[model samples]
Target chain A: MTDQPWIAVDAMGGDEGLEVMLAGVARARRRFEGLHFYLVGDEARIRAGLHSHPNLSANSEIVHAPEVVGSSEKPSQAIRRSKVTSMGIAIDLVKQGRAAAMVSSGNTGALMAMAKLSLRMLPGIDRPALAAPLPTLGDNDVVMLDLGANTEVDARNLVQFAVMGAAYARVILDLDRPRVALLNIGSEDQKGTDWIREAAAELRAATHLPLDFTGFVEGDKLARGHVDVIVCDGFAGNIALKTAEGTARFVGDLLKRAFTSSVRSKLGFLISRPATQLLRDHLDPNNHNGAVFLGLKGIVMKSHGGANELGVATAIANAAKMARADLTRRIAEDLGLEHVA
Target chain B: MTDQPWIAVDAMGGDEGLEVMLAGVARARRRFEGLHFYLVGDEARIRAGLHSHPNLSANSEIVHAPEVVGSSEKPSQAIRRSKVTSMGIAIDLVKQGRAAAMVSSGNTGALMAMAKLSLRMLPGIDRPALAAPLPTLGDNDVVMLDLGANTEVDARNLVQFAVMGAAYARVILDLDRPRVALLNIGSEDQKGTDWIREAAAELRAATHLPLDFTGFVEGDKLARGHVDVIVCDGFAGNIALKTAEGTARFVGDLLKRAFTSSVRSKLGFLISRPATQLLRDHLDPNNHNGAVFLGLKGIVMKSHGGANELGVATAIANAAKMARADLTRRIAEDLGLEHVA
Candidate 1:
């Protein structure tokens, strides 16, 4: 890993504003010695947050950007107009080699837009995808890709997603030839639409790849951890992710009610507190903090916009890990982006 | 509510054979007093099984159905060729008023086909939909419709599902003007396709209907009980239902492992037995048994083919309730089927 201390953070982004982002950066810096943050946001607010923490202030630098991109702003328009926006500046730092990687907890669309525009797509990639490691029933998590990044995708795009996702699993999760599967209604070879079927055929025929390309996987297998990488178009992936999140929330809420129902039950819950905490930690979304926008030339991690300090810290760690792993070099080499238009 | 002592069951249907079905029937009969069963299957085998239980033999009748409908067989062809098939014969009994309502834990495709072909669709109904009550966060359950019965749907069909679902809720759950919402990706007024948007408009303008008629609801809201009736096309509804089931199973398996991780945790789990049981009962798919294929002239309930005896009993009770409530009449009146076609 490079001894470069600074990482660029989009401070003006996210629902919680600069305070949460700055707080997360401060926490990450405290945990990692020699880690410095180039906090990109309005100078006044970033300084206000840094004023309280002398240790964090000593290592951090604030880069002033006049305009802030609103969450609702069109990604393309924001990228073109707001060069001085915190998110835009963060991406620019990566492009200029001022920072090893960039972190954003902002409008996902804007982050992808700026990342692509500034750093450019890796050689053979047609489109970049957002990949998140989701907690499964098994000991390890599965890497699922294109979670609301591209709404409409073709067969070729899905295959590309699989390749990138496999690479991500290897570099980030330390998997060897990560088993990849396409998400579908059923596991049958001919279960999905023409695009999915065609993609399955292509994935099967390609023997030159470094990954273990398994055929189709049903939604039920998602949490089973039957495969290391689950590839799909954004629409389906988004639905699956949100459905899982909703189910988790529902189950958690139900458990809470059950535990608090009666005096005896409450006592029982107190005794089983450790077991319950283990389950909660395993399922906690915050623990699985960062989503990497793959197929880009530079590392760009998108934390959940509503994530608290711990979540942001996790995202920072993820960004640092991705940078340390030399993710961009691996992608450019494996995907053979040099031959692309 | 009928004084009829025996209900005819299609024993030859379902993935589990006559033995399991007979076992379920015997269990239900023992628990529900005055409940006798007309076991429709190979009479020789039914008699052989009943040899040990003289009471079951005396109380139950075996209608010999020489043929069985395979799960993979085309529904139309099965209904056409197999007049003596258990599912076909079961529906025939209901049609001839020999039984109050027929129960089938069999090939869903065949049951739906025979029900539509033999019992026929309720007057003015364009297509029949399968509606099931799903347990939600609130005290009551949400009624979701068209769970894989009809793939291609129009705006008018969705409106019809809302009506059917609402009527089912009133008849079964005894809810007044149960809030109905069209399931879509977003709750915005103009989010979905033209068909869904137009349907939303119609639902909003439906003043004469006995429904609260809440606008659009997202997938997450299904568990939150924000709305009582969730109407969607069969494809989307099927996906959502399966996803929920898969997720619930995944989480349940994870919790089991977590609770049994260590001796201390296991002891704590034993102490929390009642609370755990309550949680299990609340989330049990068996308790929420029987998906009724609504909009048909005769009551037809499809229990999960893999369901055990308790599931079959729940399905039988569901059919009995539908028969008692005369769901067909209410559905016909609610949809204004007489005026439609």
Candidate 2:
């Protein structure tokens, strides 16, 4: 493994300001020995945050990007004109091999666009998909993909997604012959759209691939951890992902309100503190941290836009792990993209 | 209000057997005054269960249907051949005005197919849709439609769903101008498919409709109760509905595991039973018991195939409320379908 420890972070991204990003970087650096950071954003704002942490400031480098890509800006426009934006420069560092990988908590569309445009897709890859780790009942978490990358796709694209996702499962989660499935309306072969039916056939026919190609999986099977990699078009995937997140929040809030409703419940909650902590850790979005933009030639992880210090720190750690694992190279080799011109 | 209190129920439908159905019907009769039921199913099984429940036997009548439709059977095939199937006869009773409404806990596709073939769509209604009440954060619930009725729909069908959903919301939730929203990938007007875009434009231009047409609501807003009526194609809506249900179960199960991980935690959980019960009641799928097949000429409520006594009782109550409010007639009038012929 490479000894390089610095992570290029787009400090100007996310809904929060430089304070949270810088704090996250500081926290990560403090926790991990010899960890360094390249904070890409406005020099003035970053410096203001670093002033409180002398040790973090000593270990960190600030790269000034004159423009910041706003979350509301169109992705294509942001990619074209905002060359000096923090996110753009952060991806540039990764592309130029100055940084191992890049992490951004910005507009997901823009981040995906910039990362793809800057590093380019791996050989034989038609599109780059996003995969996030979802907590499951099983020993390991599940990997769900194409959360919001390509809205409309054909059978061939879905097959390719399965290939890439299988490679991801192997490299990221260390699963052998990862059980891969296509997200459909039902579990049967002929349940979904014609495209899905055709794709299911294609997935079944791929004998040479090193994947346990399971049959179709419905949305209900997602949290059940039946399949390792769940693939679908970005539209359905986005809905499922956001819905899960929202439901988790809703249920968590409901439990909190329930606990505080009465004195007896409050005492019970206090007694269950250890269990509650474990539960919170398991459901915490920060633990999942990063969603990798797969099929790209380089590593780029997108943190949730509303992520806090802990979330950002976890994202930085995720990017570092991907870099050490050389995830892109492994994906290329596994997908036979290495032979492609 | 019509004093005729009998509801024609399909006993041979659902995953559960005739005993469960009889139990549910018995519970419904005991809960509601002046309630009568026409249980249509296999003669022997229905009578066997009714024989045990003497009180239910007095108020209930069994319509002997020799054949039963399997949950996996094709809807068209089931409807074409099994004329005397429990579900078909239940719809027929409603068609002949023997019962105010029909309730089934069967294959949704079969129910919709039989209802469409027997009851026919209301005038000016292109297609019938399924509307299910989703519990929201607010005091009132949101009615989401096209749950799994029409797999493919045109812009006009969505417009019709909006009208029907708004009418149901008005009568059920008692909202004057029920806020209607087209479920889209994004809140923007041009975000989704061509059909959704066209539907949004038409809904925006509509002046005679009795609704506060919200432009769009994303999947996350469904739980937040941001809109009263959420409209979408059957495929996406089904995926969303199933996903929410699965996630709710996943979270609930996860909490249970967390609480039972240790003896101390179990004790804490025991003490907090009241709060847990409250949360469970709030998130119970049975609480929102029935999915109404809207835009049909008469009322039809589809209960969960796995629902127990409480769920069936709730479905009966929901059907009774719809019948008393004359929900189908109101929807027809609002859509100007009553005079279309």
Candidate 3:
């Protein structure tokens, strides 16, 4: 870990183009001191966007890229045809050891495909899982993984996810022994399929790992603010994550409608604005934007494509924290592989 | 459709005892007139419970069931030893043609195992899928299925689940052309794995069905009120259902905390009491208690084990509605089998 970590930012990625990305970089620079950035994009446009942020331009050096990856572009097409796209160039810089970490908000599949191929997986990891921090009720957010990385995982893969997840939680949650739980419909041992049960057995036997393997936790327990890491295959993880988001949004919408239906309720909503703002901050997706692709040799943070400037800044800060913590080395040591760095 | 539908009630199935079951029966009888119930439990306890429900007693008869399956008992163990248990006997009544449908709030796994073995599957059905009505934004609820029935299903089973879910939705939601969609992380064609894609292809090919195949729907669209039926394998379905419930409760808890934080907010809560009531009624588990096991020879609704009297009554009313609508016959006809009513 270094005091000054340089992060590669794909200036042309995300729903918004260079301006939003550069503004976020400026904001993040103010948040985290002694940080440098490799701004990968068209040099002219990068300079034009940086006109608003004198501090960001002083800290960032532009790496010229002629092409950009479209949001709808297929992973294979992006990899094969547009090798010089900002997303691809940023990922390449991480592989070349010029950047400690990379952040991109491009097409998810395309970014994942490019990152996995460019940096490659860690020696012992068969596949890298998409790890995201979910907002729980407690002070520290819970880390959930395989959030649409590999839809189908076998027993060995699940055990590996457990190991990787524990290591990631140790860095992000700053806990010596994070309580890990497998997500299931029921908490009983005999519940769920054979694969999950087999993984539990394997995890139980692997006493060398530094995690408390509390048996099975249901989907309802995911937001209860207790468990540190909730493990599941990408299929269930994606469903649970999206469903919780949808339901929250639905409730938020319902509250808005209810409050605006009449004059008394409308004034009540105004009176309770502070309390509602606290609730909004707690449930806001921007506060928990960055989702990292774990198990790769080099760290790659994925910001949500439609995230705002603050969200992009949040993702960049997360990337810097994970990089400074040497998350990759932590995972390598936990898997009993020789530490890459 | 029968005017006088006789349903079997498992008096000792739920977390609450016979008193709660009988009280629910009383409430359900008030909701649906000319409905008869055959209460299956211990004779002494049944009579004691019936003492409070004079109206239900007038329309109900007790069938003595000596044994009771413990909540923690395995399905295989319960089947081998407890044939005369309240849950088992209620299902047996449906099998013997003494009851039109059965309602139980017992061990879900044990109930499923016993019901499948006793009443058997429908003619063209390979296996049974658990179908439940989920609250949506419109006047009607959306029906989602394969909720913990078959954890791992093939393309063929997913197609079957689609057929069953559409039929269930048709009767429950009362829509002529129920919009059915396969549940996936994304609505795109190449979003999920092989099974889901294959199932989508098959559903698209089968234009003979009465449903409007609306491609794929994401988890967020489950409560949007437009899609009539959402189909997925049991594992994903279970997680989605529980996650939605958990998120709704999470929001409700947050609202409570927000409203009670200070004097001004608490007074605002009082002024907006009517609006909060609406939200409460919308998110109440008691208002949405019935989850029916579809593709069986007879209708079987599984209520939550810890459901209160209101939840139990909701389940009974749902069973009566299904029985009158001849839900099994509708499903059989859709699958190209002879309608069994």
Candidate 4:
């Protein structure tokens, strides 16, 4: 791992086209010294955009990809046309070992489909999981996994998600060993489905793994940050993630209505604006901009499709960090798939 | 269906014991005129507590019971000793037609078990579902069902939940035909399991029901208020409810920390204390107090275990309203089980 290890970027993907993508790449390069980028998209458009940022242009090269994947495209359809798509070629760079990692703010399903096809699954891994950092009351954010990768998971899949999540937490959060828990309806011993209970049994007896397997955690304890890694099937995990987001928005709306109800409160709001600003920044989802696809052959991070330059830059920084840490290899080692490498 | 119908209360259940329970009953008696209470617990202790409120004593009668179910006790274990426990007897009062409805702040599983066993399921209903009103940005609260009554539910169970939830909304929220939606991880038709997809298809093609099936809603759109009835299996529904609760608490805690940070902010907080208080009250779980067990032969509401006097009173008020509206009978009519009744 070097400071200049190449990180692939899907220039034609994301909400704001090449403009925001290049700006984010420039911002990331400014922060991480000697950073190199492979911009995969239309070379003419990328070169035109890069002309505004001389430093980023000097350290980057463009790989032209004429086609692009639409957000509405089916995964099966996207896979057939991956060879010509910007997101597809970027993922190909990782598979070909020309780039250490690939980052996209494009069509999520398409990105997942192309990455899975090109990189393939690691040894002993039936499926890869989508993981992201969620804000918590504790000092460090907790990592939650299988957000929407695999809808239905068996006990073995849940156990694999635990291993992948723990390894990712160790690399990103810099923890030696992390406490892992299964997300269930209730914290009781017999609360959830047979698969969850079976997974709990397996994790409890898994003496070879370097994880502290706490039995079960209710959904309300998710943001309390008592555990480092929380694992669940994509269906439940995805629902939990969105429910939290909606609740945050609901609270914010209520606070605003309360603050603006009277002139006295308005004056008070101005006085306490700075304090509320701090809270606002912390609660903002943009601060947590990166969600990586774990258990792939190479690192692939998904930026928010509608993320701004700062959000995109955060994803790039996380991608660069994961590539530098050799995250995929670490996951392989944790799964006892080191021999496969 | 009179306002003075006897409503059973579990006097010995919940964290605060007999004192809070009686106080809440007293408060409800004051709020709603001609409300009679069937207190199920130890008669001596109840009489001692009732001495503090002559008004409540005049309107209440005690049903003695010596047994109590521990919160840690499993449903199977609780069912074995159902005849003696306060919660079990309270439910029995409803089944025996001695009380119009039952309200408890006790072991939820035990209460569900006892109620289901005593009352039995309504005709055309496979199993009972737990439902409660959740706050929303719209004018009225949304009704969500299967909050953990059954661990898993099939397509038919989901449809039945919709019918019951819509009926509850009609009585509680006073809507003619509420908009119902299935809670899924994604709004896309292809996104969930075969069970949910099948459920969605059935609801979509259902022309006989009074409900307007609005297809699918993601977890984040829950509080948007656009959909009136949100249906899911117990597992997913439970997660959504708890996740929303946790997120609200997390946000509130962060806001408090922000308000207390600086001298300027402290002065501003004093000026806007009323406004923030309004926000806190709105966010409090006490205001949204009662969670009803639907599909039962009779009405049974579950109050928050650690709720304060005000919280308990809210649950009691809701119980009185549901009892007067004849919620169980309305659900029976909706399920075409009125003939059986």
Candidate 5:
């Protein structure tokens, strides 16, 4: 406990190879002083990349990993090669107590499969939910979970997700009682699948929990910033998340076209550069990078594969924060209290 | 067919009630020269409302229905009172062969329940799918289906939705062979639930069908203007749709704030008014209002409950277009072909 817990980095993962990952770790080093890392990847390449990133090199140790997990590899296939692969070794660092957390911008399914097999699920969690922060108009980002993790989840799974999500919000957003809502087609009690209604009933009765259950929320109200945690089955959650991302990008594209449509518009765009830049920063996926795989024993953060240095740093910071907050322990305690109630 | 079909309008439905509905019909009358309407609502209100719109009055007749379906009413409750409800009577006009199609902005659950019971499903269709046109970067809007009609659907239901959605797209988008894709979390074949994979396999094998069965599209690609028809189960479809709507509005809200943040931004906004207007029109829900209940015996269009006069008119125009194109017959024929294949 005296020694600082190391955070593992999959230096070989993502679309950009070892250089970007190492550089990202280097960037994160500037933000979080005293943060140490177990840089897991090809030793020679990582060493070579670290030449350009002296800051990361000082705070990190190279752990050689012979193989790399391909982005297109199936979870099963990736799991088979987890022992020697960078993603697998990084996860093993977390399991072996060498690292408190791991960060990877690798094959999502592969990373998830490896992390589950290595770290395993927390005590009370039947299935792990993939939770991520979505930028909202409110003071804090809303955490949405079970995003393509469990395609078909029962009421019990949904209820557990809500508990886990609330715990996560407490750690990440620093809220005492996060307002949680079940995602539905309509806000009415009778709306959505039977499982959803049952989950709603259970959540409504869960007065002993630290979280405040805010009832149902439709897809349209997600970014309105009213609720802190939104829970749903992976199928709907994934669709909603991707749809929101696509729509934001779609409108951004249209905005670009609109600004370039005429000479007068071009002048206006030039004059409004700062204002539009703020909007851009708000909408950028990179600014809101890092999707945490909750319900796991050890912290594992997944960065957007196409993300740049700042995004990777954000993911690392997020993972480090979760680790420091003892998110796993908090969730376990909440689940224990929930079970008692 | 030669006598010219009357499109039934639920004049007392929607948030705006008789005034907006009648005004929308009057506007549609201006666009579609010979379009007749069987306005179903309170007799006195219709007659009084028609006084302002001489265009609609000359082209249409009114049917009296004293009862109005409240937006909060359950579908079962509404169905029990369908005999006296304006929405129910309008649908009955279609079933009784007095009107070619019906348009309502009333309680969607009630409207769907009434329409399904009154019109019945087309042959080879098990459950009805709600299809709506969504704005895209393409020349024509993409038609997505099963938008909260059937919460759960099998592979067979999905296959049928694709066929119905394609048929709707052909009539609405006027494409010879619309590109159809199954909505999934990933573009990969094995990314989703068993039913989704099964549906994909079925759709891939359905080469004899009119639609070009593209493999799979993620929710983010929904507005990319690549596919003409995106098909999925009602739950995911509804979530994706509302998420898109919510994201668009979220961004629009942010844009407004950005423009008004400073005097410089305000000046820029004024100069770029025309360009922003184009974007606003492109993203407006009213420009894409009508949602068709596909696979039904009669065409029933559900407009957005909060839609304005222009939105109502757009829905009416969409319903009239589908009626003229014989959308129901086309879908039935396509289903017959699919069954044979």
Candidate 6:
């Protein structure tokens, strides 16, 4: 029985099963020495996979679960199987104080549903927002929130998201005051919906919060690195985030086509491989895999279903970092301050 | 006086004023022989600028305007000065049938306001949509619509956008039955708002339209080339378009930095300049510059304010193409068919 913080892992959640998940845990364990894992899944399969990762097996505890949540299963259906399913039990471990956080690569709708139902929201937060760090041209990656959590949000929901997002950014980016802005079509005061305008007015009035309200930012300026935290309703945020990803991949595909156009170009690509490799590393989705569900009572990190071992490990590391930083407590304190203000 | 189609040019609208706009028109005129221009701006400056382009000066006639709409001016304010301003007069030329189309690189809000006020919406259309062609991995560019034209739209508006967007795509992409889709957070039927779901239901029911409704698409797949037209509310469309542009530019910047990082990379860049130039041309916004205000009684094109000569010419060319294809009539006919269905 170690006193080290434990992160519950839904071992059977992702597209790749026990072997890849265990390998990812092993890799994460090497990077984070003080973290232990609650490997919740089929005990027999997990135990068999553990033979390959001796170091991880020594630090992990297996809990058997008979059912696995289907990737296409509805959240409502998945929630009914909370007691028997691996994903549900892993989340339960966090609720029971056996684990500090939970990470899953299962159906996003299911995870969000279960987490929201089981953990519930923080005192000031009406809803939990999905926050992720996107690569930017500045010194730090920008934190964006509500990436499909609440498709529709009012002014109050947006203000709470801002407080929660700013607190999360402060812990993750190590900044005292993160610059937050609403995502809109234009930067003008009269831009966007009444909800966005109202939220901006509230944020502007919140001078005592640990964030600098930078008014509004458009989608094209998202990766320009002008603002630290970009907030919007889930519909817009999800659209912007996914569009950026698609564009990045589109450019990469074009580069490949360009480099392979001729033999001379191929030679140039070879010579420029080191430099291009650096750019590739910067743009790789695996390097920035984890997306945290902010404003929840307990931490829940989502790993991309198609992510490889490195991506999964990155997600685990992110969960451990948030737990170590006491992000939930920090957010609660921020919300309290906001309430007082 | 000539029988050639005349495109009204807002000579004083863009950032560079007369020089860039005239140069762009001259370039476009060289490519399109059967085109004339109504150069609307300060008569003295346009005459002086056109002296350098003898060919354009021979084909174009100057329509003097006393005022230039300020880039930061509100739409309501700009709409009042429609009788005197360059952008307003250019739109007026279209409304009066003196010009086949109008091209401006001025304030987007001002242009949209003036065009809508002057030209009015086509029959069976409630609102005009801003449609633009985006580069894709496929042989043809994909058309996206309602890019900041209407911030909030109902199911009827979305369905209207789909019909108009498909008509525009058929003209622009030269396709028989352009595959159309509604942009949402997810492809699942139950994923988005009620409006989106209702719009999807309507589109799925309409089989008599010229477009092939392919169901829903996400932001990340906007440029994937599977669908010909993507329809969304102006807010989401604008965010997706701008984010795509920003990400492309971000990647380009990173590529530049990568190529200049090492001595070997610098040499490689010199050798691969041709290939990279090809990529640059493909990604350049100028190549895809023109955005048309669809469902309008007259053709109106909006150019990027900061676009160079090539960009403005592309906008002019796009306007000319739309005018020649009789895009407005096509959309009107599509809408009538939709109404009947």
When summed lDDT is taken over every stretch of 10 residues in candidate 3 chain A, the lowest stretch is: A332-341
Task: Report the C-alpha displacement of residue B123, candidate 3, in angstroms.
Answer: 1.3
Q: Deviation in angstroms for B314 in model 6?
A: 0.3
> What is the C-alpha local distance difference test score of each model?
0.81, 0.85, 0.88, 0.90, 0.90, 0.92
B257-286 in candidate 4: lDDT tens per residue? 888999888878888889989988877898
User: Residue-wise lDDT of candidate 1 within B218-311, one digit each (tens)?
Assistant: 7666799888888987756766787788888887887788778878777777877888789888888878888989988777888888888777
Candidate 4 Cα misplacement greater than 4 A, ranges: A337-341, B337-341
Model 5 interface CAPRI class: high
What candidate 3 gets wrong by more than 4 Å, as runs, is A337-341, B337-341
Ordered list by lDDT, greatest first: 6, 5, 4, 3, 2, 1
Which candidate number has the best DockQ? 6
Better of 3 and 6 by lDDT: 6
lDDT of 3: 0.88
Misplaced by over 4 Å in model 2 are A1-6, A337-341, B337-341
Tens-place lDDT digits, model 5, residues B1-341:
42356899999989987899988888888988979999999999889988999887678989999999999999899999999999999999999988999999999999998899989989889999999989898888899998989999999999999998898888878888899999998887788989989998998898999999998899889999999999999889899999999999999999999989999998999999899999999888998998989989999999999888899999999988888888888888888989888
Report the alpha-carbon TM-score of model 5 versus the true structure.
Answer: 0.98
TM-score for candidate 1, please give it: 0.88
Give the winner by TM-score: 1 or 3: 3
DockQ of 2: 0.67
Instruction: List the RMSD of every prediction in angstroms.
Output: 3.6, 2.4, 2.2, 2.1, 1.2, 1.4
DockQ of each: 0.43, 0.67, 0.72, 0.81, 0.86, 0.88
Model 3 per-residue lDDT tens digits across residues B148-240: 988899998998899889888888788888899999987778889899999999889877788888998888778988788999999999999
The stretch of ten residues in a row with the least summed lDDT in candidate 6 chain A is: A1-10
* List of chain A TM-scores, every candidate: 0.95, 0.94, 0.97, 0.97, 0.98, 0.98
Give the per-prediction TM-score of chain B.
0.93, 0.95, 0.97, 0.97, 0.98, 0.98
Query: Between which residue pairs do clashes occur in model 6?
Result: none
The alpha-carbon deviation from the true structure for residue A147 of candidate 4, after best TM-score superposition, in angstroms, is: 0.7
Candidate 4, TM-score of its B chain = 0.97
